[model samples]
Target: MTEATNDTTSPVRPLRDALTFLLIVSATFGLQLLTLVTGIIMARLLGVEGRGVIALVLAVSVFAAQLSFGGCLPPAITKLLAERGANARDGLGHVFRRRGWLLLLPCLVAGGLMLVLLDDGAAGQRFEIAVIAVVVTLQTLFFSIIGGAMQGEGRLVRMAWVALTPQGLFTIALAVVAALDWGWSATDVLLAYIATGVLSVLVAMASLLPAERGDDVGAERRVPEASLWSEARGNYVSGVRPLDGLGLERILVGGLLGTTALGLFATGLAVSNLCRLVSNAVSVVVLPRVAAHQGDPAQQRAVVRRWFTISLVLVGGIVAVLELLVEPVIRLAFGEEFVGAVSVARWLIVADGLLALRRVLIAALQGQGRGGVASWVELALLPVLVVGIALSALRESLDGVGMSLAAVGLLSCLALGRAVFRAPSARHRGRATSCTQQRRW
Candidate 1:
């Protein structure tokens, strides 16, 4: 029997990993449910207008964070770990210590600029929104770095706890505070988010401390500096490439359709975000598996295909359900003023399904170390998105506008799917060629 078969038959390792994956998924889903309840409470307590304001601020914060972080966290961490699993334990500490300051510099400058440029009135009573954004960005960077360390070591259970607890607790706390009328203004809400972010970082840091004391048992050899730079750049490019077009498209929509229309659009996006809980759960499991098997072509392809199929089926089913119950869901979550949001949500159910497919395809690319190609694909689609959003916003009817925007999502899915299918088959071919070359050598 093969060595791998013998190892598999040993029983302990697979069981442990499977149990860990199950635990992480269960805890994550629980947290997601709590978060959903929190959102519902916030909508009920704040009313449509208030919730709209909160949504606007959040959108801006998330946009700023993406730009500041360069959207590099996931692939960077996963790649680094996969490439230098053991050495990563040592090198990452140095990388974080030195790079932390450099990363924070851009975020600080951007946050300051945003504070100066955005109308203070838009921030409303959440005047401290800018500060909260800064804090959240810093915390996110630190958390990502630490989480990367845990992932690199394959300690996913620890990583999940470090990554999710603060978010779960913060959502629960905010809902409770808001419900009780316990000094919960918009600013207070922002503060809670910032606080949660800080706590997450702290927990992640704590998780990493033990690794410092333990031996680097599985650390891979250090990658070359040039290779490391190339990988990092490629990953950053790939991750943010989609944002270039997508961000511009949103901007165009807001400018052409006005804030009220944007607000309505935002609600649809938020409803769609609920669907992501499933995608995230799957990703949390799939990503590290892909990374660990980077050398195995057949396994990699099989995993990618399986994940894509499963994600599409699951997301599609959820969207269908949401489509059927759109009106009642809106009434229960956001009250009557947001009745329009129901139709928007129904349309977005389709959009989010498309988005989930795109996400899974991109994850596969990242796993295969083709982040640069993925980035290019996103860049290619930007203009189409921008133009689509602009045209949609110009429509006279609000419902027409929503439909137009949703169409852009459908278009994106088609374009992205084509690109993913067409990606270089070189990785698979290389495996065969390498075996022949090794025999000759």
Candidate 2:
């Protein structure tokens, strides 16, 4: 399992790390490109109204996913496995039995809510959509458990494959659907996601389970006993898990606007989010390394500084290019009605850039066991987003939604800055001061 970890003090290691990072980026780009292409195809197939219903339904699906995986399982498991290195299966089994099992009830509940929304709120094709939502949520829950195991073992290439399989499968399914002239309703399109979920879980399980039978450098070593899911409690929802809150916001949009409006907004979101997809690829590779190096504060800072610079330069350059092409691209992809999407989209690209940087920052913080800072950051941002997006969508201007999201990104930047840039000793002194005041009182 040994590879180019971040713990090395070798001078030439940076070059190797850079090369490896590029590979990760390249692989990640392929996955995201597949997703973008799938979106474009789906948009063309379904037109605006179909696309909106698909977007809203998928939003609900994403929320079920979040609730099912729980917040802390992936990172917590990954961190624990990275540290122990002795018994991957024991750590993994404990995690699944504890927090992973807990996700089933929430998945069922989210699925039930999705059924209510589809049957009563969405109407038409309700049975099919509801069934897919429940089944897919259950599929994702198991897939996530295996995914956490892959990450925990630092089998990153394997992990990337698990991540990419669903997109690849869905892309292929779309092609077949198009070839067959399947009527591209929202329900018709969602079958691609559901089918892919089942297939990918099988692929991920094949990767995650093999490490149990194999021996590695850390396999025979002994360590102190601990619960697999010990870290699954507090920050699980906020910092530990992917933001379901974002999905809920989209649902809010669907409720406020009709399907067509939601589709337009979703298109703008998807376009702007392309850069975020790339940045997230960088993070997927970076997190385990960060977690491995968390014991040394000096190494942590160095690691943070290096990646922060890389993110700014890389994401900044991509943002610049995307900004220039935003208009022509939107017009070409979805036609004249969405030309206004370009204006809204440019701001969202900026927001995505900021959010991407925050990902790097949060990965570092979570690696260092300061996950509470990230949890607090999310807690603070949610209200700002909910209110801002609510007012803007109600006002019938996507420009408002774009600007509000940008504002949230900016706020996240500042919060991460406080956590990242503040000296540890200074933070300690501040905490000490607060503690003194509390004791005196």
Candidate 3:
């Protein structure tokens, strides 16, 4: 029999794929730009030291969110949804319910952690930081899960717009606060941040309801919860590897070097990380499609080659431009107070470019249910990151921290490259050539 018929066969598939990629890239850029603007607004309004407080708060909240189901489930959900014979509605609903209860653990843990860490703030201010961290964690979880579902369902165009919800809402709130010239403190800005999260969750949830109901009518058979969790556990590690660097680095910077240093480092990270737009979008678009076509090794190889090549070219251009323009851009956009971020931003830009390729390689492996391979690779690299950051701190050099991060990215790309691109063994080739029966994921 001929292979299954799908959108891949359409005559306009190239154009359509190009448009979808653009949409995803645009949305990702919007998200990054908004985050940069948010930091700028805080810096301009609150000064460097005040921005430091907000930085510490966000570092804690995001770290906690990464630890929870929000950060862990997206890749897993996307892969599950992309299974050709799987029930998107039933599978999504099943996994959502199974994992929703655990959200509380992150909320409570993050809040308590933040409360204990805030030694300098007034008791009321500390309480607010803790409470807001809890709220942000939950909201971020909803955003991520819904976004992942949308991607896995192959609604890439719609997913792009939905991805902008939280940041869009926050940008608007920040604008209002700034325009009104309210004497807003760090707490006020954070209050505004949490308010947007609430609105974003409502909007994202409401937007998905119609699709969920429509999916109800044509739902296929459900995958067992046990199987889903088995996949999720491997992907959870794969997903959190990036976050481990992100969450812990920020906490360590704040703890060892102080919040002012964190503010500079965080802002640099936000600016430099805009380079990830291409790779981030590529990973999101590539993973589900690869998963859907998992039985075909040739198709998998071709898809990875095309998308990963595109990711590299685009990211290379972005890193070069950012490297040239970042110093000026930081001064012009974020002001002189954040000029210290320039050194940090420059090195981070290189690191981000390396990370761009690493992510695509990881996505390819994850789509094949071989996420454990990449997870082990990252686990081995984790200590290198810790020691590097510690050395950076000891030297009191942000540039040192940036170099350490870049080293990790370079090593990860080299390691994962070997894994993803190596020639298939005789056994693997035989399995690929002989397999004709449809296997359940």
Candidate 4:
């Protein structure tokens, strides 16, 4: 009698995927919590005005870091790995190993330019800020590249661990130092960040090295040098433009409203953007899958739809809660002096909910190789952001400015949401016809 063939399907549940998602979400949430705690401690230690300065510096660093990286590497690596699978590891390594330095060159130049452009009352503090900016930019770029590569290789669990561990340790260390009555200067925090950044990079590189070793998959198809360069260029260009828009908006706000006001606005925005962590965690998982299924329109659409629905429902629920409890949250997390931030934080929640939904749509576009379109969309919206920020900055009162900015948030959300919904869908008959026509070429 013929023995029944064993079902060789791996018995392991999609626990790996679930764990990967959880790890990133946990890491993001932990980082936010640590920062919140650190911020609280720093406020108590440094008083309101000093805390405001720290927040300002952090805002500048965050804007610089995001603009410097251009949000390209993560999606680029994810797409390449998804399309090429395990056989693409060496090529992926080659891209990262070679272009990594080139990616950093811009950050150094931009950071220096920003520092030079700013009016510095004291040379020592200016120099310190410059150092912090450089360190922060480097830290951001390294973490993004390493994290992206790991996610592309489908080892997101390791990537998430690498991403979180250093930040977690640094946060804990900072809290200890603050509790012990160590001076809470900008230099001290910058040093802590640098130390953590170095540690995280080391861990991520070590974790990814093995996966970067190409497996014996019986001779894979060679990716052309030109094609790889073209892909990288496309990703870089597409990614940088939106980030530029965002950066420009922040810079204008900082310049027009003074650092203190910028500090308040930025803090509120950061807290609100924390909700996007949920969508981001999901995107890391969804990006690779979407890329893998790009050739199959039906499958791609199904995946995108599923993730989008889940994101909207989750983010919407969280925003509702945040809107209700924003006052208590702000007072508890950032101290009573920041009680004025409650309204701004609520507005940000509304904006972030819209942004979260837009992210899912953008991810789908990126996965489908519509980077150019995504880039154009961002460029188009730059004017809207600029106008909103300018009008808000012109206000004399903080509450008035906050309300005007909230109006901006509402407008931006509506515009972004419209763009997302109007984006080309797989189910569109016209798109299907276009796909068929393109296939003939």
Which candidate leads in lDDT?
A: 3
lDDT of 1 by residue, 1-441 (tens): 101111322558456445665676666667666655666766666554445545545555455555545465544665555544443546455455555577667556545744653443455533366566566666655665566566666666667666667768687777678667774555667677777767767777666634445454433444444554565665665555454312443444444554455556656565655455666556655554554455565676677778678787878788888787777866777577677777766766776676666666666665565555566666666666666556665664445545654565566567655654554577654653464345221
Candidate 3: tens digits of C-alpha lDDT, residues 73-152 = 77577666666433355566665577678777887888897777664633568777888888877776777778776666
* CA shift of 96, model 1, Å: 2.6
Error of 1 at 124 (Å): 6.4
Give candidate 4's whole-model lDDT: 0.61
Worst 10 residues of 3 by lDDT: 1-10
TM-score of each: 0.79, 0.85, 0.88, 0.79
Can you write out model 2's per-residue Cα lDDT over 1-441, one digit (the tens) per residue? 323344456777666566666766777778878877787788878887778777777777667666545345565565556656634565555434454556667556655766555423467666666677766667766766566667667676667656788889999999888878877677767877887878888887766644344454342232223544455555475533343233765777776766677778777877777666666666664554555554355676777787778888988988899899888888887677666567778888888888888887877776555667788888778788888888997798777887887888888878986797555665654554454344221
RMSD of each: 5.1, 5.6, 3.5, 5.9
How does candidate 3 fare on TM-score?
Answer: 0.88
Task: State in Å the error of residue 164, model 1.
Answer: 2.3
Model 4, 1-441: lDDT tens per residue? 000011213354245446666877987777767666666666566654445545545545555555555466565665555445543346455555556677667556545744653443324576667667766767777777667666666665566566667767777777888779887775676677678778877877777645433355333433444665565666765565452323554466556765556556655765677667887787765655565454466676777778778887888898988787778877777777777767777777776776666566666666665656666666666566666667667763444444544454455445544543444665653554555355331
Ranking by TM-score: 3, 2, 4, 1
TM-score of 4: 0.79
* Cα lDDT, model 3, residue 231: 67
Measured by C-alpha RMSD in angstroms, how accurate is candidate 4? 5.9
